[model samples]
Target: MDTVIAYLPSILRGTWITIAVALCSILLAVLLGLLGAWGKLAVSKVANIFADAYTTLIRGVPDLVLMLLLFYGGQQLLNDLGDYTGLWGYIEINHFTAGVFTIGFIYGAYMTETFRGAYLAIPSGQIEAGVACGMSPGLVFGRIIWPQLVRYALPSFGNNWLVLLKTTALVSVLGLHELVWESFTAGRSTRQLFSFFFVTLLIYLVLTAISDVGLRWLDRKYSVGVRRA
Candidate 1:
């Protein structure tokens, strides 16, 4: 409709923020996931217990609650630290940082499980073979375990990513200027509720579609040498 067209720029800007949030969050998630997976598999009982507690606590809590807690808790903690150092008054956390870290911290637990399963799926023989060839642990991981784990993890990773993309909508609750926030603002301003929401829905659909295609391409690329004839 004409109203939707008029709001295109606003919608696009919000979409950009949403994408940025998702990208940053996913990057954090992947890094944390890797570390968490390593911790879970570490030799030390302390490391294992810490990792287990993190995964269990994150998985058990509702994501929205976690997001709220992290945002408020982070703000308060920073403010307290600033006060201690006589830096200034309250140090506020912006919505973008809040949203990204919230999603990343929440999903990283799931990603940890995915990565762990993928690693376990790899046969012990491959690692042994690498060791027999006098490869260092790092080289063995790089040359053998890494590639296979990626291939196996792609499907689950893709699923998690798609879910993560959708979860970006929740960032609106924190007043982030993402798509849902923009749509709400536009709808309220214009009183064209259906039109703005419809546009928002379309944007989400497009994002999801693009992600699906990208994941598929990655899957193919990663599986190149191993695909059966």
Candidate 2:
């Protein structure tokens, strides 16, 4: 208990980093998800092919492999470009950026599928009705399609988010000072491996609990006026 109290500040700081990484990754995931969904649904063969290749390639790769490949590969690529431009000594790829982008890019593939399925679940008639009522395509999507997509997508979106949060732990391998990395350091320094790891477990549980509550609220908010008999 005393040791845990002593480490509270460290843990909190690390937890903040974890949260920031998750938020940034989620933002990227959402943007990529929308674009990927649009690409998958587009009539152009090139767009469809690109979307299919992205989802398939990303989904097939292991997360850790992808993370390492992205981080190291990106660094090397940047360094090579820097060398060509005579700025090799000045170029650096920060670990936080590497972690956030890697996780976001990997999970965005899954999110694309979730969004596409949700969009498909929406009835075409509703969109048509909106069109008949003199709603522009953009307005119809804004007022009708997007709302239902949110409601229908919430469950899968929440699932993907939970997984993404957990995956942030993997970024510790890249030496990011997130909770898991802190826990590892504390355990090694104090020789109280179980105690430190147990603390980390509790922290993760708390994060997941908060995420669940927030996602549920979002789900209900989006489901407004939806009736069940």
Candidate 3:
């Protein structure tokens, strides 16, 4: 107990880092998801082909392998580019940046499917009606499609977020010193592995609980005025 309390500050810092990584990754995932969904839905065959390949490739790869590749391979790519171009020198990718981007890129594929499904769930007639009523394409989507997309996507989005939160633990492999790494270090020093890991478990539960509440509120807000059969 004394040792655990002594390590509290370190654990807290790691917790904050974990949160930061997860938040940044999710934001990136959402953005990429939107763009990927658009690409899949685009009229251009090239856009559709590229988006399909992206989602398939990302979804098929293991997360840890992807992280390692991006971290090591990306740095190599940068060095190769710089060496060939003679425009700059070595640029090492930081752990935080690599962690955020790898997770985001991996989950972006899942988010693509989530958003795509949500978009399809909306009634096509409503969109046609909105267009017929002289709404611009942007306005029609903004007014009609976006709300229902949220309502439909919220469940899966929340699920993906919870998974993403857990996935942040994988970033510790990059030496980011996030929650799991911190706890492991403390546990190793104090021989209190169970205690530190237990604390880590509770912290995760708290995060997921908070996420559930927020998702519930969003679901209710977006379902407003819609009839549930």
Candidate 4:
């Protein structure tokens, strides 16, 4: 108990880093997912092909391999380009930035499918009715499409978020001082591996439990006008 208390501050700091990484990554994933969904649904063949390739490629690759490649390979690629162009000096990629972007890029593929399905689930008649009623595209989307689309998307989105939150542990391999890394360090230092790991596990379970509650609240909020079949 004393050892656990002593290590608590470091673990809490690491947990904050983990939370920050997850939040930033989720936001980026959402943005990319929205764009990918739009591209897939667009009339242009080029757009559709690009979106398909992105989702297919990312989804097929192992996440750890993708993260390593994106972090190291991307850094090398950038340095090579800089050397060739002589436009800038060698650039160092921060671990946090690399981790967030890699996670976001990988999960964006899943989110793309989620958003696409949600959008497709929306009835065309609703859209047509909105247009006929002289509502602007933005107005229609905000008042009609967005709410229902979110209602349909919320479950998958919440699942992805929970998974992504756990995935932040992978960032520890890249030398990001997140929860797993901190816990491992504390356990090694104190020679109390079981204690520290158990504590870490409890923290994760608590975080996920809170997230589940919040997601349920959001689901109810979004489903206000939705008729359950």
Off by over 4 Å in 1: 84-89, 227-229
Root-mean-square deviation (CA) per prediction: 1.6, 1.5, 1.1, 1.1
Q: Which lDDT tens digits does candidate 3 get at residues 1-229? A: 7888999999999999999999999999999999999999899999999999989999998999999999999999999999999998989889999999999999999999999999989889999999999999999988999888888999999999999999999999989989999999999989999999999999999999999999999888988998889
lDDT tens digits by residue: candidate 1, 99-215: 998999999999999999999999999899999999999999999999999999999999999999999999999999999999999999999988898889998999999999999
List, residue by residue over 36-135, the lDDT tens digit for candidate 2: 9999999999999999999999999999999999999888988888888986575677889999999999988999999999999999999999999999
lDDT values of the candidates? 0.92, 0.92, 0.94, 0.94
* Model 3 global lDDT (CA atoms, 0 to 1): 0.94
Backbone clash pairs for candidate 2 read none
Over 4 Å off, model 3: none
- Alpha-carbon lDDT of model 4: 0.94
TM-score of each: 0.95, 0.95, 0.97, 0.97
Q: Determine which window of 10 residues in candidate 4 has minimal summed lDDT.
A: 220-229
Q: What digit string (tens of lDDT, one per residue) describes model 4 on residues 1-229?
A: 7898998999999999999999999999999998999999999999999999999999999888999999999999999999999999989999999999999999999899999999999999999999999999999989988888888889999999999999998999999999999999999989999998899899999999999999999999988876789
Q: Mark the regions of model 4 whose C-alpha exceeds 4 Å error after superposition.
A: none
